[model samples]
Target: MPPIPIDNEGDPRLAAYTSIREKDLTSGHGARFIIEGKVTLETAVRRGRFALESIFIADSRIEPLAELLARVPADVPVYTAPQSVMDKVTGFPMHRGVLACGLKGEIPDPAAFLESGVSAASTLLLLSDLSNHDNIGACFRNAAAFGASAVLMDAQCCDPLYRKAIRVSSGSTLWLPYAQGGTGLDMVNAAKAAGYEVWAMTPRTDAASLTSLPVPARLAILLGAEGPGLPDEVIAACRAVRIPMSEGFDSVNVATAGAITLSHVFTAAV
Candidate 1:
């Protein structure tokens, strides 16, 4: 598809690209999400999992991204504007020179998602109350890297499709299968009913060291947000596992801790 020239920031065609920061912070434009950075845009285009509504690129980037842009469906609009105009539309310095608007489909039911590949899946992750976008994104990246079958998040976790989280994950959020929206207990019980042994991650003194525990055939590792960590009741519901740190250091970042545990469990299971 030939690039459509976009001289006016207020053009209805570019409505999805306007006030990106504000929209992302607030309602996230309903089911739509803004994809920033060339890598993320390329991932979204290549994966074709989500519906690509349109693309907005800086005029200077159009020529360089010509081959990639050609891959987009003809029906989808590809709008190009000067850097200044792009900045004005997005309300920021458009350093990446590429942005895309994608529509999210309905999230699958948690039980169905967990049961779909139960027999074949060895590992899964449950995120509880993780509000930080960067942490959520990093955790998704780690989950993808470690070969987790899917990620299930409780209602309180932040949206992985948030622009910053997507960028932080290097687009892994798009590649990974995930379902969110449920209470912590609801997620844990769903995994249990699907024949998975749920393990809650914590830094508590009584928790069994991760290295000391044997990985189960079907495992679900529950990770909580930073600071408050997992609630006592949630931890008590599952076998609590902790990473052993040096005497002086008590804990790592939630993403780092998740990666360490994932590596241990994935290696042991395989």
Candidate 2:
């Protein structure tokens, strides 16, 4: 079949490509969606999704994406364009000639998602006021790497579906469980309800160091945002704990701290 050459930027078919960030947050009826650049698109398709809608490519750069393009369904439209038009359509530079849109049906409910759905819910990740998209994305990627069950955020935090977050995550946000409501206080309450000891990672002297927290049958670790750490109230909510970082350094990036904390916390608790 001949490729569909969408030459004009204003073509109705190019609508979704125009404002990528907005398009991403639209929760369509069918499935939870994700947008993938050419390289990441390959990984997403291999991992499996509910549906693969279409693959957009630049005519000039088609060779690199050709093999992957061939794998897309015959009826799914694969639209191509010159490099300049492709960039204009996508609202970003360096698209490398492709973007793939996919839908997945498996989304975890906010309250129960962290249950781990395996042998005891051992690992968890908490976010307090982590506003940076890049940082949150890194946090999700790190959470997944550490075998964490979910990434919990306060209601005021950034949207995980925000375009920059998705791009930075390499679409890994779709692979993990997450939610935001109330504050770190809410997460502290939920963790307790779920039968886990809640440990707030802060620098206060009264807190138990990570070394001493009990090896509960289950555990939840609360990590805060960049500068402010967790609110005093939220920290108060946790059983009270710290990571014992070396003196002099202020504090680590929230995601980095979480990665480190999770590694140790899970080892002790589960």
Candidate 3:
């Protein structure tokens, strides 16, 4: 399809691309989310899990991104605008020159997603009150790398579809299946009911080390926010396991912790 030339910043056709940074915060629950940068946009186009509602690119990107543009559905609008217009529309530099609007389907219930015939050796990750977008994105990237079946997060977790998160995940956010909603305990119970042995990652001295714990036939690892870690009640409900650290160091970034734990679980399972 020939790209539509967007001359006017206020054109209604470009509404989805306007104030993108702000919209990334308020939008996405009702099926729409923004995709930024060439890598994530390419991932979105290749995955086909989310419908491409429209695409807006800086005129400078048209030639370089021609291959990716060709993969987009013919019916989806592809608009090209000057760098100035693109920056004005999105309220940013638009340096990457690629942006897209995507429509995602409803998130499935945690129980249904867990019980949906997941393999016995599968590993799942549960996040609670994880409000940092970068950590969410990095965790998703780790999940993709380790072959985690799905990532489930409580309502307090930030949206993984947020533009920065998507970009940081290198578009793995689009490839991985995720469910958001419900409390930490609710996630633990659901996983237990679905035949998963839940392991809570904590830094407590008494907890078993990740290397020492036995990998279960089916496992779900629960990771919490940075400082507080998992709620005491939530930790008590599952087996508490820790990654052994040097005596002076008690913690790592949640994303790094998740990656280390996921690698351990995946390698053990294999």
Off by over 4 Å in 2: 1-3, 21-36, 48-52, 70-76, 102-109, 112-120, 266-270
Clashes of each: 0, 0, 0
Checking candidate 3 for backbone clashes, the offending pairs are none
Model 3, 31: alpha-carbon shift in Å? 3.2
How do the predictions measure up, each by TM-score?
A: 0.95, 0.81, 0.95
Check candidate 2 and list the clashing pairs: none
lDDT of 2 by residue, 1-270 (tens): 446888788888766677574455435445444465665566555654336667677787577767776677787787788888877776777455666655544444335554554324576777777789899888888877777776777766776766467667776676566766665676678777777787788877778877776656667778777777888888777777776777775477777777777777556544
Relative to the unseen true structure, what is the C-alpha lDDT of residue 95 in candidate 3, on a scale of 0 to 100? 88
- Please give the CA lDDT of all the candidate structures: 0.87, 0.69, 0.87
Q: What tens digits encode model 1's per-residue C-alpha lDDT throughout 1-270?
A: 789998988888988888888776324334888899889988998984788889999999988898888889999989999999999998889998999998887776567677676335789888999999999999999998998978999889988889999999989888788888778988898888988899899988898998898788889999998899999888888999889999878789999999998999878867
**What is candidate 3's lDDT per residue for 1-270, written digit by digit as tens?**
889998899999988788877755334455688898898988989984787889999999999999889888999989999999999998879889899988876776577677775434378989999999899999999999998978989888988888888988989988788887788899899989988899999999999999988888789999999998999999999999999999899899999999999999888767
Ranking by TM-score: 3, 1, 2
Better of 2 and 3 by lDDT: 3
